[model samples]
Structures are given as structure tokens and as C-alpha cells.
Target: MDLSIKGTNFLGYLPSQKGTQTFSTFSCRYQKSNEEVFHQITESELEIALEKASAASEKYALAPIEKRRNFLREIIALLEEHRTLLVQQFSKESSLSEDRGNVELARTQAQIQTYLDFISRKDWNLLHSQELNGVSFEKRLCPIGPVVVFGASNFPFAYSTVGGDVASALAAGNPVIYKANPFHAGLSEMVAGIVLQAAENNDLPDGVFSLVQGNDYWIGETLLKDERVKAVGFTGSVRGGEALLNYAKERKTPIPVFCEMGSLNPVFIFKDAFEGRTKEMVEKLSSAIKNDGGQFCTKPGLLFIEERGSEMFINAMRDEFTSAAAVPLLHPSIYNSFLKLSSVFDRFPVYRVEATAPEYSVYPQLTEMTAKEFSAFPAAKEEVFGPFSIIVKCADESEMKACFETIGGHLAASVWTDQSLSEEWMYLLSSRVGRIIKNGVSTGVAVIDSMHHGGNFPSTSDSRFTAVGKDAIYRFLQPVTLQNFKS
Candidate 1:
């Protein structure tokens, strides 16, 4: 994995007295091979970066919105121009297929476009009402100060480096200090350089977007607690995200931490729907489970199927999963963890379905449990990271409701139904899921303006915010009010 943190000699970049930066040696996970490496950045450097960025933010924001739009347009153009190399890097580092990498790359660019389109729009600004009764009301959107963007390990270009986090932060007129994911440090540097290059060409400030190589959790804690940082964005495991959020809250000057931890996105299938489209459902299931090695946060890890289709669904799920190509997980730890947890599912007494092939060898597995049993069971509530799913068979519609009630918070949910069932259940699920899907797979999250990519509680630190789509800017922007103004 050619894992190397660079610039050890440049400890001067560390955060000042308020910031202490140190680079450490860590093995990279994305690659099949190992390489010793070191990265150097100081707390002082981070502070300076943030300070300079903060200073430039207002000016950057004041620039013609069209110019910002053009910058993102250029970025999209560059992404397309270098699409081939980006695809290759993604495949080599993440062990993803070239096609999947390309799709992600395209989505990443689309995210940039979405942000640009949003920023250029006039309606994104707050609206206000004025009254002649000696009082008026006004509201507006203002960029938060410097933002700390913690990138994800699974997605190098899109979710890491100058991915959605940075893109959204930039769109919000906030300078970003992106902490690259350790797994894709090289890729981070590569993309960060590109972004910096674009910024320089566009006359953006040096500190507007700075990339630091910190391969440890301590660095993130340090940054999260830093008072200069106005906001934070992260995507990773629940434990990791929660830790960051907790640290931020514990700080003397706490800040908003938008941590999209993880989710066991549930796919609910009604008895009628399941019976009619078992084959179609299975095909969709296969694609979703195997999509990008099932690394997406929105991947449907839990399936709620009615009793009648349970047997056929299990068989098809297994058949499709068995045929899925085995790809190396990002790291040996992930691989081992998936193996260990999957074994635990086999040991569970309620497990009903058998695998089409040995579970350990393949990338994803299909395991089944009855909805009643799963609802009553505490152990079944956990999420197993890799391409693993727990099928919950429901006896009836009521059982499905029970299953959902028992399920934990999720990033997204899917209801495979043609006709609306009961309005109560519909409202219940609609209120619960972050991104609700109907008659389709739950995996592919489109990068669009209206897409809601967040959910309540553990699915994300905040329910009202979205991590992707045009609305992502809201994470980096806060509402302001202006009253009795005449321009």
C-alpha cells in the first residue's frame, strides 16, 4: 500500500502553541504491499492555514458567485480530463473495479457541480420579512469559519482528500483543512495537489485549501478541539465518528461535528411485492451487496422480507452472493474483522439460511433471521462492515412494522412496494429513514441537489443535515438575519 506520510523535516508546519503536530509511521491498507512512510505537519501550520483561510474567506465569498462557479466547473473538467488516471488509482488503491471507480469519480465531479449550481443560485440566501410596526425580520446564510474535513478511508477521491467534504466547505465559502484518510494518503496528496493547483490558478489564497498528512486519531482530536475550527465533517464507523464528536463537545469551545458514522440501511419488502418480483429483487440485491464491495454507507445491510417470499429470497440472495467476485478488502484488519463477525452470525441460533458458498472466501454473504426473532434479539442489531446482510423474515405486515421499530437509526431505507400500504407505516418510515427508496436498490446514492444523505442519531450525528448533495453547504454555513436593510 505504499503508505507514507511525508515532510517529517517540516515540523514547522505543526499547529502553534495551541497546535502540536507530529507525523507517525503507519502501514497503509489500500494496497496489497507494504511501504514504510512518514508524514509531517505541525499544529502551528494548521493554525496558520486556518487563520489565512479565515482571512481570505470574506473576499472569496464576495467574489462574483460566477467565478466560484467557474472554479468548480474547471474542477469538473479536470476530473473528466484525468478520469482515466483517477479510475486506475481508485482501482489499485481500493481494490475496486475500474467501472465502479469511474462511477464514483463521476459522482464526485457531480457533487462539485451540484455545489456550484447551488452557490450560483439566488434562492440559497436567506429570505426576510419587514414590517412597518417598528420591527422587521430578516435571515441570511453566512459561511462558518475554517472547517476541518476528515476524509473517509473507503473513498479516496470522492469521499477523501478534496471530496464532498472539501467541495461543500468550499462552496460555503469556508476554507478547509482536510485530514486525509491514512489508507489513501498518496491518493490524498495527489488530489490535494490538484485542488491546490486549481486554487492557485484561480488566484485563491494559499491557505484556502491545505492538506495535512496526519495518520493518527490524536491529530483529529486535536483539530476537533481547536477553537479556531468552526465546524467539522467526517464519514466513517460509528465508534470513530462518535469519538470525534465527543471530543469536540468536550472542548472548551465546542463546535458542530457532522459525523456520518455508519448505517445498516434496511430494505423492507412487502409480501405481495416480494412474491411478484423475487427474481428482479434478487438481481437488485446482488448489485447492491456487491456495489463497490458494499463499502457505501447507504448499502442495505438489513433486509426485511415477508414470510411467503422468505425462502425464495434467501435462496436467490445466497445464489447471487456466492457468484459475487471476491475482492480484497481495503485492509487485512477489515478482512479479519468481517471474517470474525460473520462467524458469529453462523453461531446464532436464529440463523436460517445457508450460504451458496463458503462465507469467508467471498466478499459478501447473505444470512437470514426471522423478523420476530430479530426484533426480540439484541445481538442481531449490530452492523458487520463488509458486504454482509441480515435477512429478517416477517410473518406479516405487522411483523414488518415490529422489525422496523426494533431496527436502529439508519442512513437510508428502502420500501419495495408499488401501491401504498397503510399511511401510518409510510409516514413512520418516511420520518425515520434519511434517504427513502422505493422500487429500487438502496445502494446507489445519486449526487444531486435534493438528495438527503443523512439520518437520525447513529446514522449521523445530526438528522437535519445532509453530507452530500447541494444542501451539504448548509453544514458549513450558518443562518444569519438582516433587518431593515436598503441596498
Candidate 2:
């Protein structure tokens, strides 16, 4: 594939080794070693980037809202200029289908446009609170200094360089340093060049946007622990996020680590909706289970059902899953690990439903357990992470409530119900999930201003923010109170 930017583009150029394309960059060695892997961009480069971004952030934050909106609008137009090529490159690297990749491409553009539209009217800095004692009190949102963003592997373009995290950070007037996913290191570098060009064209400061493409996790740890990095945004596994958070906590002046971890996002199937249209629900769910090969953070890992309708739903769901073919997970390591997990599940006492899938692809299966059996079994609560879901049966309303309470926190919880039942279940859902749904699969999350894509505890390190929508910006920002204003 041709490199993205033309002529003298430093960030766009990858270090080619003897005709082989190996994605490698300067990485911080954390384990008994002190060596810079790729000598060009070293710790000094990052320190300089941090200093420049921090200095520019003060001025960037004071820029008028209209100017900021214009900057993003220009970015959107430039992205549109290379839209087709960008989408194609993203698909080729990520192995996503044309339609799915196109949707994500559009979502990324929409996020930019949404932020543009959002800033056009919304005074993100207006502090209008009144005060007593002949003194005025007002609180407003301010940008935290340079933010370090660690992109998730599953989303290359939309969640990598200049993704939602970047969009929100920029909107809040914060500078960014993106650590791109290794799986798409080349693609990440290409997009990072575009962002830098956009920054230059807008007369934004140099070092406002930087990209570090490395294979190791230590670079991320070092960046997080850096005192200049005021905040962090991450989307990935629990193990990875927790490791980074621990590193941040160990820092002398620890910054906020907003890490979005794994979520066994559950889909609750009420009798009314299941009985209303069993086949449709089955088909809808089957596609969701396999969407993007079930790598989404919102992918439903657990399904709750009433005991009376469990059999019917299971049979239909099984029929759909058996026919569904699997795709390779993001990386070979993930695929190998998944196979091991599947084998372990097969040996467990938990009921395992047998199903068929394409050769080398993961097969979907349904494991059914009674209300008491499911609740008593902690194994059922674990997130299998790919095309796998557990069917937890509740004997009745009381059991269902207990099941929801017993279940761990999730990024999202879905409710499938008819009119009356939907109303009845809304209360239960509000308490159980961060993002609640009605009569739909929870796999496809729309990137919009109102969408709350993050959740409590294990779903994310913090419950107050989201990773996929306008709320995502909150992760990079903190409130600043200003007093005694003179106009």
C-alpha cells in the first residue's frame, strides 16, 4: 500500500528493514534494560512534545469557540478529501467487511462533525452560576494539559489517532500525544501525519499532536507516569488497563487514568419480547454475536432469560449460532488464547451447548443454567471475549432481580421486551447498566453526542465517563472554578 502523505513526511515514513515491513519504534524498556529501540524518537522527543503542548494549551484554551469549531470543520473536510483511500486502508488492516468498515469510517467523521456542531452553539466554557454576598461564583470546564491517549487495538481509525479521544481532548483545548495500536502501526502513523498537517494548516502549535508507534507496553507505562501528561484515555482489556493504572498510581504526581476495561455487557431477554418475535430476536442476536468478530467492548457476553421461555430462545439462538461462521480474532495470540479458553469451558461443569463453525473459526454455543444454578456458579459471569455468551435462566421476577444484582457491573445492559413489559423492565435495567437499551442487540454502538459508552467498575476504571461519544471528552477534562471576574 502507498504511504498516506506525500513528500518529506517524517511521521508517514516507517522504518523498513531489508524489504520487510516490521512495525517497530523507540520503546521504553521497563524490564532490567535501558535502551532506546528506535533511536529517532526517544524520551527527549516525548519530553519536548510535552513541554510544547503544555505551553500551547494555555493559549489554545483561550481561543474563541468559533475558531476551534472552524479548525475541526477543516479537519473533517480534509478527512473527506481522503475518505475512500482511508476507509480502504482501514478495512485492509483491520480485516473488517466493507459495510462495517464504512460505517466506522462514517462514525469517525460524524464524531468530528458532531463536535463541530456541538461547539457551534454550546458554550463549553460559559460559567453562569450566581453567587451570594455581593460576589459572583461560577464554575466552568477547562482543558487539562497534554493528554496521552493509548488507542485500543480493535478500532484503528475511529479509536486510534484523532479518534473520539483526540476529538474530545481537542474540543476541551488539550493537546494530545497518541500511542497507536501496534496492529495498525503503519496506519496509525499515516493518520498521525494527517493530524499534524491539519494542525500546521490551522496554525496550531507544533507538538500539539504526536504519535508513538511501539510494540511494547512499557512506552505506555512511561508516558502515563510522566508528570507532564495530565490525563489518560484508554480502551482495552482489564489486565492491560489495570497495569497502566497501577503505574500511574505509583507516579510521584499521579494523573487520572481513565481506562475503559472489559465488560461482559449483558442482554436481558424478557418473556414478552422473546415470545413476541422469537425468530427475529434470534437472527438479530446471531449477527451481533459475530459482528466485528465479537471484539467490541459492547459485545454481549451474557444473556439473561426467564426459565419459562428459556428453551424456545435457546433452540432458536442455537440454530442461528450453529449456522454462523467465525472470523479470526485481532491477533494470532488472541486466537490461540481463545481456543484455550474454549477448551477450558468445555471441561467445566457449566453446561456447554455444542455448535458448528467454519474451520479455524470459533463456533458459537449456548450454555444454559437454572436461576439458582446460574447465580450460584461464578464461572458463568466471566466474559469469554468472543462469539460466546452464557444463557442465565431466572425462575421468576424475584430471581431475575437477584441475578441482575449478583452480576458484576457492565459497560452496557440491554432489555428486550414488548410495550408493557418494556416499561416494567426499564426500572430494573436503569439500576443494572450504564447504557440501557430497548429491543435491540448491544453490539453496535453509535458514535453520537448523547451516547454514554462507558460504565462502572470493571467496565471502566471510572464510572463517570464514556469512551465512544461526546461524554468521552469528559475523560480528558476536569472542572476549573474561576472567581472575581472582571469584564
Candidate 3:
């Protein structure tokens, strides 16, 4: 693949724009060890990227839908051909295992293919015209122009460079400018090269797809505030996403910011299910907390259980969690934050539950508190962002209901029950989460047609749209109705 404007072997893309200014650059390092360096990007270079994206959208927005579908097909073909190397690079930059890298890379391709299939099916006749008295009405989806995607640290391939947001925006015929997560800088550049080559193979404009990398927040802010950028797609911490959203709102021409901030993803355990399958539930909850060191946005943070068999279940869960192996977080800042957030339970109200601490400085921690104690302290609801969970013992059904009311929005919420008295509890949980995962953990988010991977405030900026699945393409689509037109 071709290298970028930077004086390094590593690939990068500084979009062709007018009035580009020279920038002061910063170096990229591997997440764990800072020995060897990757490519460097400048905060000022983002200006050109946004300008080029606006220019590309002019052509891409008018391009035939079939041509756009062909672009996605070519991207999938290139991704498959370069899968092995991309996975290896991803594993190196990200602390995740090789198996996880392969799975995420494959999922990225599947996301693109899913969008392609949705557009091809004739049943989805989005372009339709109706004849009225002396006039004709036609309605269709139009691209919202230039969009910027912020890479997710957790799933580098699925949510990063050529991830869901990128595929969705491009599939909707919007020019995309991706701001790669600094944590996985090298991996982002590698994936960007593959995407650029695919774009070239299909004769896409230089601005149709551009990747910008930087070590500062200003770079992201610059893109969000740009008038040329019509929408923003992000997957990261609540603080970071909130910052970008605020910047977008502050702009003279406010644009829509689809920010998928992290979620608490609480799990409620009813008495019937807990008593019937104590051992099964323990293993399931334990397995849920171990994936990627509990770094998923859907990791169950607060678990509610009635006082009946709650003690025994808690003991079983503690044993399973402590015995499991420890996996480090994506970066050091995440590790530090994990320690500080989990340590909040070391106070008077909340206490440790026989946690078998890991050999490393950073590892999983388990804490416990009564519903009465948790209610006393509102700060207990804050997200810890690691392999940590708080088991809450409720006095009764009424107390549990009260506890549920105090909670805020979540991307995913789960309930473990035997289908007895589920209606009432499911209704109570309906407003708390975006997707009610029944009888299963919310750690795994599927890329499918009906999947709703977004939620109300605190979970995401806008609950009306999803960041995953087929519906995600609609985020970049603006409705256009033609009136008094000839068919």
C-alpha cells in the first residue's frame, strides 16, 4: 500500500485541502510498552481532512446507489485479502489476543456486507413516487454530507478504522473522515491503507475516505466544529464523547453528534431464576465479567438480587470471578481509572467480597453493598470501566423497584428468569435500557438487522439511532421528499 505525506514507512492520509497550515506533530506509541514508535499526526492537519471530505460528499451524495454498493463490495474483498496481517497488527497495538483480533476483523467485513445486502433487496424500495391530483410525491433518503468517526478502543476493527460507523456512513453515500484512537495508532494506519487501496480500486475520490491520527483532543474538536462535517459518530468514554458533543453544539451551525458513550449495563436477578439455577447463573455471570477484562460497553456493572438466596449466589459468583485469569486493560490510563473506580467500594457502606486479587498491579475486583446502602450514596452508580462488579442485595420486591427507579440510561440491561412473573419486571426494565437481553449476558453485541445497539441519554447522545446493525446506516441519511415532481 502507498504511504502518506508523513516522512515514515507507516501509512497515513492528509486529505488534499486548500490553505493547509504546517503542524507541530506528536509521536504514536504501542499501548503497553513505549519502546518503538508508530506514525505521528498533527492536530492542525485535521483542517485539510474536513475540507476534502466536504468536497468528496458533493460527488458521493449524487453517485448512483449501485456504485456505492460496489464500493463496499470491493472493500470487503480487500479486507479478506489483508485479514491475517491486520489481525496481527491489531493484536500488537491492542492488548487483546490474536483470536479476538481475527473475530473483530471478520465482524467488520460482515458489517459492510450486511449494509450491501440491505440495499440490494428490492423489498426495501426506498425510492417510491405516489401520484396525487395534479401532482406527484416522491420520498427517498439522501446523504447528510461529510461525517467524522472516532475509533473505539475496545473493538479496533469492528468499531475503529473500517468499522461499523465508517461502513454505515460510506454506505449512506457520505464522505467519511476517521479519527483513529491513539491507543491503537499503528493498527489504524494499517487498516486505513487497506481502505484507501479499496477506494482506489473502485476509483473513489481522495476525500471519500481519509484517516487522521493525533495525540490530542484538539484534533477531534477541530473536526467536530467544522461546518463541513454534517454528523459525528463516536464510541469511547462518557467524558470524551460529552466533550465532542458539546463542541458540536457550540458551533454556529450545530450538527448531530451520535456519541455511543460507555454504559453501566446493569443485570437484574429475580428470585425465581436465582433459586432454580444458582450454579448456572454463577458461571454465566462469571464468564460475562471476563471478556477483554470487562472492557465492553455492555459489561454488567450493578447486579440486583433479592435477599432470599442472594448470599449463596454471591459467594458462588465471588469464587468464579476471583478464580478467573486477569487480562490487562487497553491502556494505562484505563488501568489507573479502573483501580480508582473499584476502590470506591472500600468505604463504610460497600465492602470487598473475598476477591482473589491478580498477580499484576491491575486486575479484577469485586465489591458488595445492600440496596439500602447503595441508595444512600448516589455516587455508587458511577461506571468503573474494568473487570469489576457490584452485587446489591435488595430487601424485597418493593425495595428492588425503588432501586431501579434511581438508575439512569444504559446501552444494555439483562434479566435472568425462568419466564415466571417476567412481564412485570420486564416492563420495569423497559425504560432503563435500550435492549433488554433476556436470559443471556449483554457482553456480546450481534451485527444483525434487528439489533438495537444504542440507548437514551448517558448510554448515547441520541437514542433514536443505533451505532451497530443495518439501521446504523440511517444515522447518515436525511429524509428528502420531492413534491410536484414528474415520475
Model 2 ranges with Cα > 4 A deviation = 1-41, 63-67, 131-133, 348-360, 419-428
lDDT of each: 0.72, 0.69, 0.76
In model 1, the worst 10-residue window by lDDT is: 9-18
Clash counts for the predictions, in order: 15, 0, 0
lDDT of 1 by residue, 1-487 (tens): 1122233211112322222443322222343353424355555665566677667677777766666777677777767776777676666656667787787788898888888887777767765556666766678888887888888877777788668888998888877888877665556665665676566667765567777676666678778887788899999888989899789878888788998887888888887776677888888877887665677787788888877846777777777766666655765556667778777777543232344433223356777777767877676777777777888877787888877887668888888877775788768777777877888877777788778889987888988998878888888888887766633
Residue 180, candidate 1: Cα error in Å is: 0.4
Best-fitting candidate, scored by lDDT: 3
What does the lDDT come to for candidate 3?
0.76
**Candidate 2 Cα lDDT to native:** 0.69
234 Cα displacement, candidate 3 (Å): 0.7
Residue 138's lDDT in candidate 3: 78
TM-score versus the correct structure, for each prediction:
0.88, 0.86, 0.91
Per lDDT, what order, best first?
A: 3, 1, 2
Candidate achieving higher lDDT, 1 or 3 = 3
Q: List the residue pairs that clash in candidate 2.
A: none
